[model samples]
Target: MMTDLVTSQPAMRRLRLSPTLSKYIARQYLSWFCSFFFAIVAIIYLATIVDLLDRLATKDVSLGITLNMAFLKLPYLSQEVMPFTILFAAMATFWRLTRSHELVVARAAGVSVWQFLLPVLASSVVLGALAVCALNPLSSVLLSRYERLEANYVRNQASMLAVSETGLWLRQADESGQSVIHAESIKPGSVALQQVMVFRYAEQDRFVDRIDAREAQLQSGRWLLFDAWLARPGVPSEFHEQLALPTDLTADNIQDSFAPPETISFWNLPGFISLMQAAGFSATPHRLQFHRLLALPMLFAAMVLLAATFSLRPQRRGRVGVVILAGMLTGFLLYFLSNFVFAIGLSGTIPVVLAAWAPAGVSLMLGVAMLLHLEDG
Candidate 1:
């Protein structure tokens, strides 16, 4: 009994860390994280600028606008690669410390691996939280602007659709001019609308006519309005049992016109989901995004754990290259797994929660298992 108690005391001591030591270790990890993060983002920004310039080569867009587009897109791109940044940053931090024998000295002093890792893990959690809460909204806003710029300058088209609690708004434009359509409600899984209004405009933005309809259906290249009343300026209103309006919009176009889930801020997702569902549209993508944001901190912690397993070794081990390669491969594998699972979730083949959380949960468990094998076995 006495022997057991003595052994437990050492384990308890190993679990504790001094505030100063914790702060130092956390600072070191964050320093490396910021360095790698900015370096990677800079490279991505340059690449994006080049790509934009190429896309606008045939267009008359100014270089300033092209640069602006890239800048707006950079935050979203950073979000996409953040997990890898954390993983590589963690790996570099641990590898450097191990090579410097700082961790080695701590281990000799009876500071267990878990004790020193606490600070890094905590830092990662905080970083992940900040990314989700702060960076995500910023990224979403910038990405939305980037899309608008791309549509206006690169694609030479304006946004065609918007959905909200009030209803759905759609705009179609062609050589004939433009029409704006509004519907208070939409039929589930179809392009049929109820309580519709269409506003027509002629060339040079001249007001042409307005139509109010009880129902409207989008067919191949036109909208068929039933029981519609047409009113034109300086002319008598007319009632029609049926009317057809030419449109460049199709059902597929309407579906594609929705704001991509990535462009919606995390804070706005829940309300957006509610709006979509209330409007009889699928909210699966937004739901998935919300869950993914909720799981980000856990994912970051898992990354740190995985990085530790690969890098917390002595410099004399002589397997540094192999370890680094293996770590990178593992990171890539996890990324692929996440994408594949997200696809399945988006297709409704798996629950959103499972698809969003599984990769991080699995990676975390694997990291914990490996750490146990190395430290205790």
Candidate 2:
């Protein structure tokens, strides 16, 4: 009996696939899915662009600048709609599988549901990572360009930037002196003035002295004016004097005179925050934006999970229209809640980090719970 059993036990074999077959299947699936996704995205994108153009046209925006601004805005629009595209694609794919009973056949062939989900999970991860790293950089560049274009053609305003080649000129006034500073440049968080000149006026607009310097830098809380020359009002025509001039303004004061942080990119948030603090300005919004950027991937994952929970239920006996409506309602509610939390976060009622992450965290937990209940329990 033992010898018979040993002879009956054949060697286990592994299944193999031909490279050509594998490539063909991959190409087919990619072609089908990409076609479907792009079609939907194109329709939505075009509608949005048309509406924006119509609104701007009424405001006297030139056609060329309007087109440029709209194209520059495409990256942000794509980012905003990508999660919805993922949801629709997943729903359509599963619906097709169910309608044709392909899912049934796969299950009959011993393919687990988890096994079927592996490809989707992998794709979602790759897309999420790309949205953060590659897409964000492109969006930042386009956004900067769009702002400049808008200022030039659409809006009659200019955004002041910090650096300039002609040097930094600022008006300063106090009880002791009224001074206008002309320096080669002003560093963000440090006072390093080059080719400095200070024109001083005495009480009742009397000329006091003019001080010129080769270089000046901020140390501690004062500006150490250096390599200086002083010309007093009563000096002889052939003679000029040299003297050291001191200032109480520091690097922090300079930075406080600029615009807010909403215009900066995610990549520059950390450095900007440090500079803002060094310049004695509140960096709360910048810190919040940093946390919000960090939470985007989790938020996107939660969106997918929420979509699956509502749309992936067994529909053999249920109304398909009702299911679709339910999915739409769920998506809308999630969107509303996320925006509400973001508004609260921006209002400073809660801590910046907590406010930025709370919506994503809650949505993820709710999605996971619903999925586990439906799929496992």
Q: Could you say which candidate leads in TM-score?
A: 1
Model 2 TM-score, 2 decimals: 0.65
Scored against the true structure, residue 364 in model 1 reaches a CA lDDT of: 91
Model 1: worst 10 consecutive residues (lDDT sum):
313-322
Please identify model 2 stretches exceeding 4 Å from their true place: 1-61, 108-112, 161-263, 316-318
- Writing each residue's lDDT as its tens digit, candidate 2 over 1-377 gives 99877755532111222344334333433454577557865775677568668767657677666666777877766766666666565555555566667656655555555445445545655666777677766877787777676666556545432433355565555677666667765444446666788788767877687778876666664456766777776784322233344555555555554444434667776877776555344567678867876777777667666766755555856687777677767767777877777778777788888988898788779877887787675
**What TM-score would candidate 1 get against the native?**
0.93
Worst 10 residues of 2 by lDDT: 10-19
The candidate that achieves the highest lDDT relative to the unseen native structure = 1
lDDT by residue (tens digit), candidate 1, 1-377:
99999989987776577788788889899999999999999999999999998899999988899999999999999998999999999999999999888889888867888889999999999999999999999999999999998898877877888998899899988687888999998889988889999999989989899999999998988899999999999999999999999887878777778898889999999998888887777888889999999999999999999999999976446689899989989999999999999999999999999999998899899998998888995
Whole-structure CA lDDT of model 1: 0.90
RMSD to truth, every model: 2.3, 8.5
Candidate 2 whole-model C-alpha lDDT, 0 to 1 = 0.63
